[model samples]
Target: MRAMARALPSLLLRLLLTSTPGALGTNPGLVARITDKGLEYVAREGSVVLQRELLRITLPDFTGDFKIKPFGRGHFEFHSLSIHSCELRGSALTPLPGQGLSLTISDSFIRVQGEWKVRKAFVLLSPAADSKTRIQARLHGSFDVQVKGITISVNLVLGREPSGRPTVTAPGCSSHIRDVEVDISGDLGWLLNLFHNKIESRFRRVLESKICEMLQNSVTSDLQPYLQTLPVKTKIDSFAGIDYSLMEAPRATAQMLDVMFKGEIFNRDHYSPVSFLAPVMSLPEQYNRMVYFAISDYVFNTASMVYHEAGFLNFSITDDMVPPGSNIRLTTKSFRPFVPRLARLYPNMNLELQGAMASAPFLNFSPGNLSLTPLMEIEAFVLLPSSAKEPVFQLVVATNISAMLTFNTSKITGFLKPGKIQVELKESKVGVFNVELLEALLNYYILNTLYPKVNGKLAEGFPLPLLKDIRLYDPVLEIHKDFLFLGTNLQYVRA
Candidate 1:
């Protein structure tokens, strides 16, 4: 039994290692959830579109011939059929499992008015003479049409295009017209009333058919093209660009829609994938907000890697870069107390600190906390009387920083505060000196100099991938293990 148990453990390990990629293995850097509230918001916007488009419907002009019992045959023609007004009473959008979205519109009404013309033929017979036919005068007037209790149902199939953009298509669309009332008035209004059944039936069929046709056209032509215009790849700066491409078709459920994105950063001039893959990330089950956005640490790390590879992490700090009115200055005279050799070798000369990141910075997220670690090397130099620089010493600085992240409508910003700092002298041309003596000076320089510059740049923040004319409102951000969660509602503003 013991031998069999050992063999089973080995088999299980092999199975786990060879498992196919599934929900637990798929790691998307960015995820977005649109809840029922978001669907309702979209439905409200769709109501306006539905109303406008329905009002633009033009029912086909209808012509028919009717027989008057024992009198004659009359022909009528209705033309210039146009909708005068429309009112939408209710609308809703719902998600379907394994399909897409369902849009339902109910209790809508429209008023249509048109012009009509009728021609009647009357026969008169006398016993003494042959039967004679008399043609009555042509009658023309206006008619009013009222179509109420209108309902429209459409299915929007969400998909992805070849270029990684989202697509919307209404493959199945149908409309229900509950009631259509037609009123005819003219100099022979009573005659037109005799054929009311035919007129009303024709009107109902035309309205129902035209309404669905207009809706299908609007979805395919307007909504689909608009979705294709989404910015999938946007430049973050001159050096790097961010990829917000959809990974696959969105997953639709009864309550929400889930979309995954390849939130990777690449070099703008020369595109290359980051070395690491994104870790699996999941969002909370709460749906209090209209929408929720989840971002993984891989997104930020890729950005760091891109910028570092572009050589942007190297910088030179001079005395002038120091904050104004600060006691700490980047001069050999100021460093004399910490390093006596620096003062003796380069006396009264201005100092410069050239720093380069040893590697890309790393960001870690835990529950309610975010931490950043960066390792860099700094070389001290003194400006000679002839404007040349002489190396004094080199030190490697490692820092742990805690960041407080905040987001606005367009961007995510962070404020990094230093937590623990470590410094070591890597090389010394002046002479060997106690590194501990320079700790306080380095701390002051970092706090008053390096941090301020970094914080200033961070305050500018990075842009978020959002659609045009859409903004987040009432947003709340939370930090989770290996990811960040943002819950908010959306607002559409016309530009």
Candidate 2:
């Protein structure tokens, strides 16, 4: 089973990067849509990143000396200045249609704390005494700085890297600081307050300058690098891996954003192309859900082809595999009534059936249902007392299997229901017998034995092709004319 978890940050980065001008505008096998409602969710998540990066901003230390001719001379230094906490009041992420995305953060607050030390010398020259008197004072204390009404705006431009990977660059970023307050707490703290105007002005200038720098670094250094590190191909299991390469650049509208993926499955060891091509898939214009994914029949067909080529669609059945207390048995006695030659030729001998799929199964999607058709060849042999076996007959079976698709938070599962079964005689060792009679026996075997085993495996559904750390919520799966539409909101959890 595969696990379906997508990192929200990766999705946003892809969308932002691919939404550049001059998109390919080709139809995709898989289409992922982010609606306006989803933008709100993204903004909330983005604010968390902004706050964390803002706390990492490094401000230069303040060191200088000042002279007051009549009063005295003073030297002060503020060191170890750092942001201790941050609070984001509001944030918005807006789509720019043909351009890229705009991120705005307003009215945020940051608290900074550091140590300040000052030394002052007061001198007086008396004319009568003709001697100079000097008084020196030194003060060291901790200062708290609060910056409020901090606004940051970033314009993300979309472009492609030399390697054809999507890239996001911040061409414009600006910041403003509305207020800065400083408080000194220590011995002679009141005297330090005398220079509060200068201290506040210096704090405001440093913060305003570094805010935009931090925002740009968050995109180019942090987000873009993470995006580049995401794998274009992900392994589903040992047998196969899924290709999530983009079919074309993404398209953005006033209401939503769309990203197209190749959505093909390939063999792990030997890659082979499927006979059929991917049909065009289109998502419905529904904005109620935060995200929507449209998966074409090509995805399932390619998987079927891969598994079939790997010899996974073969099985062997013997008498031991039959259910207990059943009238049916894989011995000559079971078929003696229909073919007397079986009993006369191999009396009381056991029987074994080996089945292999004739070709890769094909899946079809209709208005409300999904069905699979598989053709198989089964050979039956009679076991000899000397540990030898004699071929009794070979039969070809064709079946139509329908399933009701359902999904939980992580995976999509199905409950298969048998539809129609057809059987024909290919070869026979025993005297000619009615093929209809054999079909009846085989039908009973399938309904009573084979389906139970097959459905048991089907219940353990494969994981969806979502990235890590994301889970679907309130997922609704709908079958369309050649594809499946999954609409759901997503929850991102940090690992």
Best by lDDT: 1
C-alpha displacement of 414 in model 2, angstroms? 2.5
Question: Clashing residue pairs in candidate 2, if any?
Answer: 2-463, 5-467, 6-467
Q: Listing every candidate in turn, what is its Cα RMSD in Å to the true structure after a full C-alpha superposition?
A: 4.0, 9.5
Give a tens-digit lDDT track for model 2, residues 1-495.
Answer: 123246666767778768863333344557778787777787888799889888888889987776655546788888899999999878987777877678888999999999988888878789999999897888899999989999988887655454434567898888888999999988856766887888888888889889888888888887687556434576766778877666655567788777677777789898876666787665677888988888888877787788778877677778887767656678898878877898899999999988888988878899898998889899988999999878888999998998777888866666778866888888888976766655655677777666776566457655565555677898878899898998999887876
Which parts of model 1 have CA positions greater than 4 angstroms off?
1-26, 125-131, 319-351, 382-392
Give candidate 2's TM-score. 0.80
Lowest-scoring 10 consecutive residues by lDDT in candidate 2?
20-29
TM-score of each predicted structure versus truth: 0.88, 0.80
